[model samples]
Target: MVGLHLDDIDQRILAELSVDARLSLVTLANRVHLSRNAVKQRMERMERDGVIEGYTLRRGSGPSRRVTAIMLVYRADRMRGAGVVAELARIPEVVRCDILSGEFDLLVTVVAESMDRVGEIWEHVSALPDVENTVTSVSLSRPIDRP
Candidate 1:
Protein backbone atom coordinates (compact mmCIF):
# COMPACT_ATOMS: atom_id res chain seq x y z
CA MET A 1 0.00 0.00 0.00
CA VAL A 2 3.01 2.25 -0.54
CA GLY A 3 2.21 5.60 -2.14
CA LEU A 4 -1.38 4.98 -1.19
CA HIS A 5 -3.73 7.93 -1.49
CA LEU A 6 -6.41 8.49 1.15
CA ASP A 7 -9.80 9.24 -0.34
CA ASP A 8 -12.60 11.22 1.39
CA ILE A 9 -14.16 8.02 2.76
CA ASP A 10 -10.84 6.96 4.22
CA GLN A 11 -10.47 10.38 5.80
CA ARG A 12 -13.92 10.12 7.40
CA ILE A 13 -13.08 6.70 8.78
CA LEU A 14 -9.91 8.11 10.28
CA ALA A 15 -11.76 11.08 11.78
CA GLU A 16 -14.29 8.80 13.44
CA LEU A 17 -11.59 6.47 14.69
CA SER A 18 -9.54 9.34 16.08
CA VAL A 19 -12.51 10.24 18.27
CA ASP A 20 -13.10 6.67 19.43
CA ALA A 21 -10.76 3.93 18.34
CA ARG A 22 -12.89 1.30 20.08
CA LEU A 23 -15.75 1.80 17.61
CA SER A 24 -16.90 -1.54 16.21
CA LEU A 25 -16.63 -2.13 12.47
CA VAL A 26 -20.41 -1.94 12.11
CA THR A 27 -20.63 1.28 14.09
CA LEU A 28 -17.71 2.78 12.25
CA ALA A 29 -19.21 1.84 8.92
CA ASN A 30 -22.51 3.40 9.94
CA ARG A 31 -20.83 6.63 10.96
CA VAL A 32 -18.79 6.73 7.74
CA HIS A 33 -21.81 5.72 5.63
CA LEU A 34 -20.04 2.65 4.27
CA SER A 35 -20.66 -1.07 4.41
CA ARG A 36 -18.95 -2.93 7.24
CA ASN A 37 -16.73 -4.94 4.90
CA ALA A 38 -15.78 -1.89 2.86
CA VAL A 39 -14.87 0.06 6.01
CA LYS A 40 -12.84 -2.88 7.30
CA GLN A 41 -10.93 -3.13 4.01
CA ARG A 42 -10.15 0.57 4.07
CA MET A 43 -9.01 0.38 7.71
CA GLU A 44 -6.79 -2.61 6.91
CA ARG A 45 -5.28 -0.83 3.91
CA MET A 46 -4.69 2.30 5.98
CA GLU A 47 -2.98 0.20 8.66
CA ARG A 48 -0.72 -1.39 6.02
CA ASP A 49 0.16 2.05 4.64
CA GLY A 50 0.92 3.31 8.18
CA VAL A 51 -1.88 5.84 7.92
CA ILE A 52 -3.57 4.03 10.77
CA GLU A 53 -1.11 3.03 13.41
CA GLY A 54 -1.83 1.14 16.63
CA TYR A 55 -4.90 1.75 18.79
CA THR A 56 -4.61 2.73 22.43
CA LEU A 57 -6.82 3.05 25.49
CA ARG A 58 -7.90 6.47 26.72
CA ARG A 59 -8.31 6.04 30.47
CA GLY A 60 -11.38 7.43 32.17
CA SER A 61 -11.00 10.79 33.94
CA GLY A 62 -13.01 9.71 36.94
CA PRO A 63 -12.54 11.82 40.09
CA SER A 64 -9.65 10.53 42.21
CA ARG A 65 -9.25 7.65 39.76
CA ARG A 66 -6.95 9.47 37.37
CA VAL A 67 -4.80 12.56 37.57
CA THR A 68 -3.85 14.66 34.53
CA ALA A 69 -1.01 17.12 34.73
CA ILE A 70 0.84 19.36 32.31
CA MET A 71 4.48 20.18 32.85
CA LEU A 72 6.07 23.21 31.26
CA VAL A 73 9.67 22.14 30.79
CA TYR A 74 12.56 24.43 30.01
CA ARG A 75 15.57 22.56 28.67
CA ALA A 76 19.13 23.68 29.34
CA ASP A 77 20.14 23.30 25.68
CA ARG A 78 16.66 23.81 24.16
CA MET A 79 15.84 21.69 21.09
CA ARG A 80 19.51 21.02 20.50
CA GLY A 81 19.33 18.35 23.21
CA ALA A 82 17.37 15.30 22.08
CA GLY A 83 18.44 13.27 25.10
CA VAL A 84 15.82 14.89 27.32
CA VAL A 85 13.05 13.95 24.89
CA ALA A 86 14.35 10.38 24.66
CA GLU A 87 14.40 10.04 28.44
CA LEU A 88 10.86 11.44 28.71
CA ALA A 89 9.66 8.79 26.23
CA ARG A 90 10.83 6.02 28.57
CA ILE A 91 8.39 7.17 31.29
CA PRO A 92 5.04 5.38 30.89
CA GLU A 93 3.13 8.23 32.62
CA VAL A 94 4.24 10.67 29.93
CA VAL A 95 1.36 10.48 27.49
CA ARG A 96 2.41 13.47 25.38
CA CYS A 97 5.52 15.58 24.94
CA ASP A 98 5.58 18.47 22.48
CA ILE A 99 8.54 20.67 21.63
CA LEU A 100 7.29 24.22 21.72
CA SER A 101 8.47 27.62 20.60
CA GLY A 102 9.06 30.61 22.92
CA GLU A 103 9.40 30.39 26.71
CA PHE A 104 8.80 26.67 27.18
CA ASP A 105 10.93 24.13 25.39
CA LEU A 106 8.65 21.17 26.07
CA LEU A 107 5.02 20.75 27.14
CA VAL A 108 4.69 17.34 28.78
CA THR A 109 1.30 15.79 29.52
CA VAL A 110 1.18 13.11 32.19
CA VAL A 111 -1.71 10.88 33.21
CA ALA A 112 -1.13 8.97 36.39
CA GLU A 113 -3.18 6.99 38.85
CA SER A 114 -2.75 9.55 41.66
CA MET A 115 -1.40 12.99 42.44
CA ASP A 116 1.46 11.39 44.35
CA ARG A 117 2.39 9.45 41.22
CA VAL A 118 2.29 12.66 39.20
CA GLY A 119 4.59 14.31 41.76
CA GLU A 120 6.98 11.37 41.49
CA ILE A 121 6.96 11.70 37.70
CA TRP A 122 7.62 15.42 38.06
CA GLU A 123 10.63 14.69 40.27
CA HIS A 124 11.95 12.17 37.75
CA VAL A 125 11.48 14.58 34.83
CA SER A 126 13.12 17.41 36.76
CA ALA A 127 16.13 15.14 37.41
CA LEU A 128 16.70 14.47 33.69
CA PRO A 129 20.15 15.73 32.64
CA ASP A 130 19.09 18.45 30.18
CA VAL A 131 15.96 19.56 32.03
CA GLU A 132 16.61 22.98 33.51
CA ASN A 133 13.27 23.73 35.18
CA THR A 134 9.66 22.53 35.16
CA VAL A 135 6.31 23.96 36.34
CA THR A 136 3.55 21.44 36.76
CA SER A 137 -0.20 22.13 36.96
CA VAL A 138 -2.70 19.40 37.70
CA SER A 139 -5.86 19.50 35.61
CA LEU A 140 -9.00 20.10 37.66
CA SER A 141 -11.53 19.44 34.94
CA ARG A 142 -11.74 18.49 31.29
CA PRO A 143 -14.81 19.92 29.59
CA ILE A 144 -13.63 19.33 26.05
CA ASP A 145 -11.22 16.59 24.98
CA ARG A 146 -11.31 15.83 21.28
CA PRO A 147 -8.81 13.68 19.47
Candidate 2:
Protein backbone atom coordinates (compact mmCIF):
# COMPACT_ATOMS: atom_id res chain seq x y z
CA MET A 1 0.00 0.00 0.00
CA VAL A 2 3.01 2.30 0.35
CA GLY A 3 6.39 3.15 -1.27
CA LEU A 4 5.08 2.92 -4.83
CA HIS A 5 5.65 5.88 -7.14
CA LEU A 6 3.04 6.17 -9.92
CA ASP A 7 3.51 8.56 -12.82
CA ASP A 8 0.65 9.95 -14.94
CA ILE A 9 1.18 7.49 -17.80
CA ASP A 10 1.45 4.59 -15.37
CA GLN A 11 -1.81 5.66 -13.75
CA ARG A 12 -3.53 5.97 -17.13
CA ILE A 13 -2.32 2.56 -18.25
CA LEU A 14 -3.56 0.97 -15.04
CA ALA A 15 -6.96 2.67 -15.42
CA GLU A 16 -7.26 1.45 -19.00
CA LEU A 17 -6.36 -2.10 -18.00
CA SER A 18 -8.99 -2.07 -15.24
CA VAL A 19 -11.62 -1.30 -17.91
CA ASP A 20 -10.50 -4.25 -20.06
CA ALA A 21 -7.56 -6.52 -19.27
CA ARG A 22 -7.21 -8.16 -22.67
CA LEU A 23 -6.92 -4.91 -24.59
CA SER A 24 -4.66 -5.47 -27.56
CA LEU A 25 -1.34 -3.65 -27.85
CA VAL A 26 -2.66 -1.43 -30.66
CA THR A 27 -5.77 -0.56 -28.69
CA LEU A 28 -3.61 0.28 -25.67
CA ALA A 29 -1.44 2.48 -27.85
CA ASN A 30 -4.51 4.36 -29.07
CA ARG A 31 -5.83 4.76 -25.52
CA VAL A 32 -2.48 5.78 -24.00
CA HIS A 33 -1.29 7.79 -27.02
CA LEU A 34 1.90 5.79 -27.37
CA SER A 35 3.21 3.66 -30.18
CA ARG A 36 2.01 0.06 -30.23
CA ASN A 37 5.52 -1.26 -29.66
CA ALA A 38 6.13 1.21 -26.85
CA VAL A 39 2.86 0.22 -25.17
CA LYS A 40 3.89 -3.43 -25.40
CA GLN A 41 7.26 -2.62 -23.83
CA ARG A 42 5.63 -0.64 -21.03
CA MET A 43 3.23 -3.48 -20.30
CA GLU A 44 6.09 -5.92 -20.02
CA ARG A 45 7.94 -3.46 -17.77
CA MET A 46 4.92 -2.98 -15.47
CA GLU A 47 4.39 -6.72 -15.12
CA ARG A 48 8.07 -7.30 -14.32
CA ASP A 49 7.92 -4.57 -11.65
CA GLY A 50 4.76 -6.11 -10.12
CA VAL A 51 2.80 -2.91 -10.75
CA ILE A 52 0.35 -4.75 -13.02
CA GLU A 53 -1.05 -8.15 -12.26
CA GLY A 54 -2.07 -10.75 -14.80
CA TYR A 55 -4.91 -10.27 -17.25
CA THR A 56 -8.22 -12.09 -17.33
CA LEU A 57 -11.47 -11.85 -19.27
CA ARG A 58 -14.41 -9.96 -17.75
CA ARG A 59 -17.37 -12.30 -17.22
CA GLY A 60 -20.27 -10.86 -19.16
CA SER A 61 -24.08 -11.15 -18.96
CA GLY A 62 -24.07 -14.78 -20.01
CA PRO A 63 -24.64 -18.15 -18.35
CA SER A 64 -21.42 -18.09 -16.38
CA ARG A 65 -21.41 -16.40 -12.98
CA ARG A 66 -18.75 -15.52 -10.42
CA VAL A 67 -19.97 -15.09 -6.83
CA THR A 68 -17.46 -13.35 -4.57
CA ALA A 69 -17.75 -13.97 -0.84
CA ILE A 70 -15.86 -12.63 2.15
CA MET A 71 -15.11 -15.36 4.69
CA LEU A 72 -13.66 -15.27 8.17
CA VAL A 73 -12.17 -18.54 9.36
CA TYR A 74 -11.08 -18.71 12.99
CA ARG A 75 -8.42 -21.22 13.91
CA ALA A 76 -8.18 -23.00 17.22
CA ASP A 77 -4.55 -21.83 17.45
CA ARG A 78 -3.06 -18.69 15.89
CA MET A 79 -0.62 -20.49 13.59
CA ARG A 80 -2.61 -21.15 10.38
CA GLY A 81 0.41 -19.69 8.54
CA ALA A 82 1.23 -19.07 4.89
CA GLY A 83 1.41 -22.80 4.09
CA VAL A 84 -2.25 -23.19 5.00
CA VAL A 85 -3.09 -20.09 3.02
CA ALA A 86 -1.19 -21.46 -0.01
CA GLU A 87 -3.12 -24.72 0.27
CA LEU A 88 -6.42 -22.85 0.37
CA ALA A 89 -5.38 -20.84 -2.69
CA ARG A 90 -5.04 -24.12 -4.60
CA ILE A 91 -8.80 -24.74 -4.25
CA PRO A 92 -10.41 -23.86 -7.60
CA GLU A 93 -13.23 -21.78 -6.13
CA VAL A 94 -11.05 -19.71 -3.80
CA VAL A 95 -9.91 -16.65 -5.69
CA ARG A 96 -7.65 -15.37 -2.87
CA CYS A 97 -7.10 -15.40 0.89
CA ASP A 98 -5.03 -13.46 3.38
CA ILE A 99 -4.15 -13.59 7.08
CA LEU A 100 -5.88 -10.69 8.79
CA SER A 101 -6.33 -8.96 12.13
CA GLY A 102 -9.08 -8.65 14.80
CA GLU A 103 -11.84 -11.25 15.36
CA PHE A 104 -10.71 -13.39 12.43
CA ASP A 105 -7.20 -14.57 11.70
CA LEU A 106 -7.83 -15.61 8.09
CA LEU A 107 -9.83 -13.62 5.53
CA VAL A 108 -10.80 -15.17 2.21
CA THR A 109 -12.54 -14.17 -1.00
CA VAL A 110 -14.08 -17.10 -2.81
CA VAL A 111 -15.95 -17.34 -6.08
CA ALA A 112 -18.65 -19.95 -5.90
CA GLU A 113 -22.22 -20.38 -7.19
CA SER A 114 -25.13 -21.24 -4.89
CA MET A 115 -25.30 -21.42 -1.13
CA ASP A 116 -24.97 -25.17 -1.51
CA ARG A 117 -21.61 -24.82 -3.26
CA VAL A 118 -20.30 -22.42 -0.63
CA GLY A 119 -21.51 -24.87 2.03
CA GLU A 120 -19.46 -27.57 0.32
CA ILE A 121 -16.46 -25.25 0.22
CA TRP A 122 -16.93 -24.60 3.94
CA GLU A 123 -16.52 -28.29 4.58
CA HIS A 124 -13.23 -28.36 2.66
CA VAL A 125 -11.78 -25.28 4.38
CA SER A 126 -13.13 -26.01 7.86
CA ALA A 127 -11.85 -29.57 7.83
CA LEU A 128 -8.27 -28.28 7.89
CA PRO A 129 -6.50 -28.89 11.19
CA ASP A 130 -7.21 -26.39 14.00
CA VAL A 131 -9.89 -24.61 11.99
CA GLU A 132 -12.33 -24.09 14.85
CA ASN A 133 -14.90 -21.51 13.67
CA THR A 134 -16.11 -19.91 10.45
CA VAL A 135 -18.28 -17.01 9.31
CA THR A 136 -19.26 -15.96 5.80
CA SER A 137 -20.69 -12.93 3.99
CA VAL A 138 -21.64 -12.86 0.33
CA SER A 139 -21.24 -9.91 -2.01
CA LEU A 140 -24.37 -8.98 -3.95
CA SER A 141 -22.59 -6.74 -6.47
CA ARG A 142 -19.15 -5.84 -7.75
CA PRO A 143 -17.44 -2.67 -6.50
CA ILE A 144 -16.06 -0.85 -9.51
CA ASP A 145 -12.60 0.73 -8.96
CA ARG A 146 -11.83 3.00 -11.88
CA PRO A 147 -8.29 3.71 -10.69
Candidate 3:
Protein backbone atom coordinates (compact mmCIF):
# COMPACT_ATOMS: atom_id res chain seq x y z
CA MET A 1 0.00 0.00 0.00
CA VAL A 2 2.56 2.51 -1.18
CA GLY A 3 -0.07 5.05 -2.14
CA LEU A 4 -2.42 4.20 0.70
CA HIS A 5 -5.33 6.55 1.22
CA LEU A 6 -7.23 7.16 4.45
CA ASP A 7 -11.01 7.33 4.53
CA ASP A 8 -13.32 9.10 7.02
CA ILE A 9 -13.22 6.30 9.58
CA ASP A 10 -9.47 6.13 9.36
CA GLN A 11 -9.22 9.88 9.80
CA ARG A 12 -11.50 9.75 12.83
CA ILE A 13 -9.42 6.99 14.36
CA LEU A 14 -6.28 9.02 13.93
CA ALA A 15 -7.92 12.12 15.40
CA GLU A 16 -9.07 10.23 18.47
CA LEU A 17 -5.67 8.64 18.89
CA SER A 18 -3.96 12.01 18.67
CA VAL A 19 -6.00 13.24 21.62
CA ASP A 20 -5.34 10.11 23.72
CA ALA A 21 -3.17 7.29 22.44
CA ARG A 22 -3.91 5.17 25.54
CA LEU A 23 -7.56 4.83 24.53
CA SER A 24 -8.61 1.18 24.60
CA LEU A 25 -9.59 -0.56 21.38
CA VAL A 26 -13.19 -0.80 22.59
CA THR A 27 -13.29 2.89 23.51
CA LEU A 28 -11.76 3.91 20.19
CA ALA A 29 -14.24 1.72 18.34
CA ASN A 30 -17.12 3.23 20.27
CA ARG A 31 -15.95 6.77 19.46
CA VAL A 32 -15.58 5.87 15.78
CA HIS A 33 -18.81 3.85 15.65
CA LEU A 34 -17.07 0.62 14.71
CA SER A 35 -16.66 -2.84 16.23
CA ARG A 36 -13.58 -3.57 18.32
CA ASN A 37 -12.27 -6.15 15.83
CA ALA A 38 -12.80 -3.78 12.90
CA VAL A 39 -11.04 -0.94 14.70
CA LYS A 40 -8.14 -3.22 15.57
CA GLN A 41 -7.82 -4.34 11.95
CA ARG A 42 -7.84 -0.75 10.70
CA MET A 43 -5.27 0.34 13.28
CA GLU A 44 -3.07 -2.61 12.36
CA ARG A 45 -3.34 -1.73 8.68
CA MET A 46 -2.50 1.88 9.43
CA GLU A 47 0.57 0.80 11.37
CA ARG A 48 1.72 -1.41 8.49
CA ASP A 49 1.09 1.43 6.00
CA GLY A 50 3.23 3.78 8.09
CA VAL A 51 0.30 6.08 8.83
CA ILE A 52 0.33 5.27 12.52
CA GLU A 53 3.71 5.48 14.18
CA GLY A 54 4.56 4.64 17.80
CA TYR A 55 2.67 6.42 20.56
CA THR A 56 4.29 8.66 23.16
CA LEU A 57 3.33 9.86 26.63
CA ARG A 58 2.77 13.59 27.05
CA ARG A 59 3.86 14.61 30.53
CA GLY A 60 1.83 17.11 32.53
CA SER A 61 3.09 20.55 33.59
CA GLY A 62 2.41 22.15 36.97
CA PRO A 63 4.00 24.50 39.46
CA SER A 64 7.49 23.36 40.49
CA ARG A 65 7.10 20.37 38.20
CA ARG A 66 8.18 21.55 34.73
CA VAL A 67 9.36 24.78 33.18
CA THR A 68 8.05 25.81 29.78
CA ALA A 69 9.48 28.59 27.66
CA ILE A 70 9.08 30.03 24.19
CA MET A 71 12.10 31.11 22.24
CA LEU A 72 11.82 33.38 19.22
CA VAL A 73 14.89 32.72 17.10
CA TYR A 74 16.38 34.81 14.34
CA ARG A 75 18.79 32.99 12.07
CA ALA A 76 21.57 34.56 10.03
CA ASP A 77 20.68 32.56 6.95
CA ARG A 78 16.97 33.17 7.60
CA MET A 79 15.00 30.17 6.36
CA ARG A 80 17.42 29.20 3.63
CA GLY A 81 19.10 26.35 5.54
CA ALA A 82 17.97 23.52 7.81
CA GLY A 83 21.18 23.29 9.84
CA VAL A 84 19.83 25.24 12.81
CA VAL A 85 16.62 23.20 12.93
CA ALA A 86 18.58 19.95 12.67
CA GLU A 87 20.69 21.00 15.65
CA LEU A 88 17.63 22.02 17.66
CA ALA A 89 16.09 18.58 16.98
CA ARG A 90 18.93 16.95 18.91
CA ILE A 91 17.94 18.75 22.14
CA PRO A 92 15.29 16.62 23.88
CA GLU A 93 13.85 19.60 25.79
CA VAL A 94 12.85 21.38 22.64
CA VAL A 95 9.31 20.19 22.16
CA ARG A 96 8.00 22.29 19.26
CA CYS A 97 9.51 24.52 16.61
CA ASP A 98 7.52 26.42 14.02
CA ILE A 99 8.64 28.56 11.07
CA LEU A 100 6.96 31.90 11.25
CA SER A 101 6.15 34.74 8.82
CA GLY A 102 7.24 37.63 11.02
CA GLU A 103 10.45 39.09 12.44
CA PHE A 104 11.32 35.81 14.09
CA ASP A 105 12.37 33.01 11.78
CA LEU A 106 11.49 30.18 14.13
CA LEU A 107 9.36 29.92 17.27
CA VAL A 108 10.69 27.20 19.58
CA THR A 109 8.82 25.80 22.57
CA VAL A 110 10.99 24.15 25.22
CA VAL A 111 9.76 22.19 28.21
CA ALA A 112 12.60 21.52 30.59
CA GLU A 113 12.93 20.23 34.13
CA SER A 114 14.06 23.56 35.55
CA MET A 115 14.72 27.20 34.78
CA ASP A 116 18.46 26.50 34.73
CA ARG A 117 17.95 23.90 32.02
CA VAL A 118 16.00 26.42 30.01
CA GLY A 119 18.89 28.81 30.39
CA GLU A 120 21.31 26.15 29.19
CA ILE A 121 19.13 25.45 26.15
CA TRP A 122 18.88 29.17 25.48
CA GLU A 123 22.63 29.56 25.65
CA HIS A 124 23.19 26.58 23.37
CA VAL A 125 20.70 27.95 20.86
CA SER A 126 22.23 31.44 21.11
CA ALA A 127 25.70 30.08 20.43
CA LEU A 128 24.67 28.22 17.29
CA PRO A 129 26.59 29.38 14.21
CA ASP A 130 23.53 30.27 12.15
CA VAL A 131 21.57 31.79 15.02
CA GLU A 132 21.64 35.58 15.00
CA ASN A 133 19.45 36.37 18.03
CA THR A 134 16.85 34.85 20.31
CA VAL A 135 14.16 36.19 22.66
CA THR A 136 12.93 33.83 25.34
CA SER A 137 9.90 34.06 27.65
CA VAL A 138 9.12 31.57 30.40
CA SER A 139 5.53 30.52 30.94
CA LEU A 140 4.15 31.80 34.22
CA SER A 141 0.87 29.93 34.17
CA ARG A 142 -0.69 27.70 31.55
CA PRO A 143 -4.28 28.85 31.78
CA ILE A 144 -5.40 27.36 28.50
CA ASP A 145 -3.21 24.63 27.12
CA ARG A 146 -5.01 22.36 24.71
CA PRO A 147 -2.09 20.00 24.19
Please state the error at residue 123 of candidate 1 in Å.
0.5
Candidate 1 local lDDT, 38-136, one digit each (tens): 999998888888777799886676634667899999999987967787677556567667889999999988877789999899999899888899999
Ranking the candidates on TM-score from highest down gives 3, 1, 2
Candidate 1 local lDDT, residue 37: 98
Q: Please report the candidate that would top lDDT against the real structure.
A: 3
Model 2, residue 68: what's the lDDT?
Answer: 69
Question: In candidate 3, where is summed lDDT lowest over 10 consecutive residues?
Answer: 57-66
Better of 1 and 2 by TM-score: 1
The TM-score values for the models, in the order shown, are: 0.59, 0.52, 0.59
Error of 3 at 19 (Å): 14
lDDT of 2: 0.71
Cα RMSD (Å) between model 3 and the true structure? 7.6
lDDT of each: 0.81, 0.71, 0.84
lDDT, candidate 1, equals: 0.81
Candidate 1: regions farther than 4 A off = 1-64
Q: Model 3, residue 9: what's the lDDT?
A: 80
